[model samples]
Target chain A: MDGMVLVITSGKGGVGKTTTVANIGAALAALGRRVVLVDADIGLRNLDVVMGLENRIVYDIVNVMENKDLPVRKALIKDKRVESLFLLPAAQTRDKDAIKPEQMKELCEELRQEFDYVLIDCPAGIEQGFRNAVAGADLALIVTTPEVSAVRDADRIIGLVEAEGLRGPRLILNRLRPDMVKRREMMDIEDVLDILHIDLLGVVPDDEAIIISTNKGEPIAFDNNSKAGQAYRNIARRLEGEEVPFQSFDNPSFFQRLRQLVGMDK
Target chain B: MALLDFLSRVLNRDEGSKETAKQRLQLVLVQDRASVNPHLLEELKEDLIGVISRYLEIDLSAMEINLESGGGDTVALVANIPVRQVRRSQQK
Candidate 1:
């Protein structure tokens, strides 16, 4: 079966693209799917570190392309916790110019034949890195935060994705603070979607656990307590075309709320 | 205390608040897709004045244009022209 090539990218940096890739890949694997997370950020690789597979990288997409002795299966580091999840690290030595778009597409095709979900970690900016990253993808998962600059870049990327004849990009609004938005101090979810005008994949709340997970090389999805982690899991489900109810991040106290029934004398 | 809380609740509540994220997102995206900043937009208006005045009698002072964000309050473009006043004077 042909695999789904979903490139997780945001044109602007530091908006949690790699984090989303790590967590979503982990979540998908936990759901019993064979998923391979490819780090296409070349020379600026970080997905491996985010996925906690940094110390295990021997070969990468570059190696596979250069006809090196390293086997594709060997380059793929399997997660011990999630049996089906694997990571193909980016080459730290090579630049984005080293690879072409067609080569990236061919690499994805080869991986597609073997895996179920091929998630690509695209580098930031609309340069060769961005072009090479989305070359092989069937769908693009545009990640953005509540901030304006990131949203702007995400818009440009989505337009480019559509121009490439790919489907209209799906959105993952990461690191959102509902409380701040409720205070009118920050932009809320509706304001974001109204501009992008794409179907919402999921909303990830701003949570410190994501940072802790990154430091430990653990994906936030495994925690299940942090809001961001839960968001990533829901995103994984939505990507699988499952109907998942989005939690009201603005009202986290609602779940704990059970209205008291006051007695009315008849 | 109850009154204070109630007042805060009533005055601070945003009925259409749920749509804020989507609303702000749309405005940013439009600017992003266009690659044209507000300053550049002003420059375009100024340049248009030079091009437009060559043949047509247009209102140079009454042109008002802005980037839109849709929560329906002030999301659409508002443009005014002085053609009506000029035409009325001509008719008189």
Candidate 2:
């Protein structure tokens, strides 16, 4: 197809796959690329809710796949805020096995014709849903946390994705607490990199703004002051073939905080 | 000196949670990649002893079989069996 297909997956749940999809999709759309997010996690669909388009999803992906007469455009929900962004919400009432891998691949191939990026938000676990998500994609992004269990699951998922013949499923380390890492209470980036041994895509710090954004059904990538938003923006830039330096997770200096307090910094 | 060192260790508590996690992950990943359980490693060690005893009088008490992470994305099966004595015919 003309556009690239990227599957965002984490073998373990709650590692920020949906959040990453929402933010990265918004960031890319802001960069003037036509981006369509396909929520492959059928039974547990939340991409629409995360993007505040839950009310706009009239026709879900399962309806499109189950009915041959149904056009793909009918299920496509265009973002009211972003000009080039769209989302194909998953079927919450149906089970994950309701859609097959082949069907998902055909849908993605069809999407790739009209968009510059077709990002599939994969479901948790190495089950049918995971298979369906990766079937259509030529590229993969494995989301993981610094915790041991998450990293282990991510390693297994990476092996499975590579076995599928997909190329360069880069790593996105999520929910990294810089203060805990400095105090040696949590795993540092260096230690995680040593074990995973994959190219670093981007590191998102644990920010409270993320939860607030999710609650409001808005992506933090739109907030210019949010650190996590800045990280997602950088990741979008990198995906556009730009060499962006990794953001330092260092805690804000006292001077910087003082500057902010005095309304001298934005 | 021993008492002072003990006091310092208790007071400093330098090693953090991340170090413990790293150690645990390294160990678990090695075992996972090698697909060898603790019981299997012991059984393999016993079988090696049975085969090697025909030529050498080895110290079974000092034998160790460990699954360690090696260089270049590989897991190495490390076997350390102490040889106490050698048979005459097998000597080179």
Which number leads on TM-score?
2
Model 1 bad stretches (over 4 Å): A68-70, A251-256, A260-266, B1-32, B35-92
What lDDT does the true structure give each of the candidates?
0.81, 0.90
State the TM-score of candidate 2 restricted to chain B: 0.57
Return the top candidate by DockQ: 2
In lDDT terms, which candidate is top? 2
Flag regions of model 2 displaced more than 4 Å: A252-266, B1-10, B36-92
- Model 2, TM vs. native: 0.81
Q: Compared with the true structure, what per-residue lDDT tens digits does model 2 show for residues B1-92?
A: 95885576569986777888887788778677456235677687889988898899999888888877676445678888899988888644
Per-residue CA lDDT of candidate 2, range A1-266, in tens? 49999999989999999999999999999999999999998888899999999998799999999999999988899998899999999999999989989999899889999999999999999989999999999999999999999998888888889879999789999999998887677998789889988888899999999999999999999999999999999999999999999998796799999998999996
Clashes of each: 19, 0
Model 2, residue A223: C-alpha shift (Å): 0.6
Q: What is the C-alpha RMSD of each candidate to the true structure, in Å?
A: 6.8, 7.0
In candidate 2, position A139 carries an lDDT of 95
